[model samples]
Target: MSKKCSFLYGTLAVVLGIATSGSMVGSVYATDYSGSETIDLSADITDGIIIKSGANITLNLNGHTISTTESEDTIYVENGATLTISGDGEITNIAGKANIFNNGTVTINGGKITHAGSYYAILNHGEMIIEDATVTSTSEGNSMVVNGYYNYTSTDERIGYVEGKGIANPTMTINGGTFTGDIKNCIYKGDDGSINNISGGTFSGAAACVLQNVNEMTISGGDFTNNNSGYPVINNQYYDDEIDKGVVTIEGGNFTSADENSPLFENGDNSTIEISGGSYSLEPDEEFIVDGIGFNQQDNNRWEIDAPEEPETLPTVTEEQNPATADDILTTAGILATLMLGLLAIIGALGFNKRRA
Candidate 1:
């Protein structure tokens, strides 16, 4: 081969090697976090972050992004582990499952978590706390769901008994954050012992802002909005016979709805709502009443409702005694004139009798 030809071939080989190395450098695999560790991502990650058992991990996005293209959670926290996310980063999951499947505790202090075409932004079976963050679900699913599982054991006649255990209930607490979604329910609590507490944040949904099933919910300070029609801003539905009642207490917050027919509170089966202090405003056609129920005005800033009751009616006036007719006025004046004439006659008769004596 000529020298020029050899130089050209060497140049092509060098370009190919560089391209291959660059591709290798850009590709990132799934990371398994064990023990106590902190990982700060400097580039976009393509795989998920897994926290193994007995691990306490903190994954800081560091202004980067973690994305997953598969139908899986972007971050999976296993049992007996904890994951804390900090920094103003992003976690994008273009999957069908939840973006965060938390079996253990998961705390998000600052970040943006988005789930597109997913069931939920966060399916928490353990505990989740969002202090300052934004979580969104961009599909027909909920933005956040706190659910539970059941455990059972099956025994075979020929073999030993097999035991299976799973999550039972979950809890979520939001101190300051934003949860928005265009779905059936933005925030849902599906199992017993599932509790949701919102001290400060903004929650909006397309159909229903929140739906709790036989659970307890407390909201101190927040803003809740529902955009759809014929649905309440907060709906507490009964689960089953075993757990027939759900309780919701609103100490302080702001509740509004875009639908005219939607009330501020909806109580299903055996649910109760106690509003201690909140600014609840609805559309012109909307009201602060419950559907097919009654509420008690506990105080100036509080309202409690437990069961259905008849509304109180105002006392009826007797039409102000027919507004004093003309006949009545004339009769009263005649009686007064008669009394004056009798008094004058009695005085004249007494003077004449004294003169005669």
Candidate 2:
């Protein structure tokens, strides 16, 4: 079916599904679109959309909202599926689970995933690339919960989740986004992968970023503000095993905390956190500081790079005050010439007197 017909049917389904209030009754539309498909929502949708199989779906909000009042995800992508969300629209879940639940590849280019059920705004189990988006929750929950893999061998298996364990990591590259929530950790990175790069984003929460069983992570740029007074800006939890230990490289960013004396970073045991760059409101752990980089306090509770010292200058000397000046040499030469001429005239006068005698 065409996109125009899909929108008409979607809106009609929502309208006809309920008689009293505008709500969806039973199971919403589940899309198993093969190959590639783009669905543009002309009106707001009060249902959930699931991308099944190996299909690739691009759902454009088109300046509209796709939300559901039921306890379900606004958009769900099954394993092996690919979903690319675009437009300046909103994907919200009211009194429900995460706004966008992904078990496959999901790339959010531009949009907002806001949920209210104190759950993750975006629960990512597979590869996720958030270039630009606003993933936030009003209640107390992590904004973006990234999972890798863990042992969930049970009837209710929650993949990529195991209390405080994450082994096989997921691949997530967050180039740009606006992630905020009133939770302990804004971005819960339980998936410890070797290639997780968070280049740019705006994060604000109790602890702006958290890392557990991290293999390797490089955060080159971002704006992180920790609102909670007790927590640090970046908290890397400890893992006991030697093989599971990993490194965290912080190249550049703006890290600050609301509390003046609170530490900006907490490097738990067994993790090597090398902070070579960034601006902080409080001091970081001395162990994480890299060599050659000066850490100076710019202002109250502000620490950044320290500038080098200036060179010293000497006083200027005048020619008149100097002993070996050109004027003194000329005066001595004139005196010597006058004295020599007088001596020659005296010798000539004596010789003339002797000749007369």
Q: Which one is best on lDDT? A: 2
Give the per-residue lDDT of model 2 (tens digit) for 1-357: 555335534674554352323332221233434566666666787656766656777777889888766677777767678889999999888755778776778899998877677766666666789899987766564435555533333223245333322223456788898877655555556443324678898877644443333555788988888776766677665454432356678888888776776667767777778988888777766778898776778856577776567878777787656767688799999999999999999999999999999
TM-scores vs. true structure, each candidate: 0.64, 0.70
Whole-model lDDT, model 2: 0.67
Residue-level lDDT of model 1, residues 109-226, one tens digit each, is 9999887774767766677888988877766644365453221122431111122212444678889888777666646554554667779888777566554555777788888777
Check candidate 2 and list the clashing pairs: none
* Lowest summed lDDT window (length 10), candidate 2: 18-27
TM-score of 1: 0.64
- What overall lDDT goes with each candidate model? 0.63, 0.67
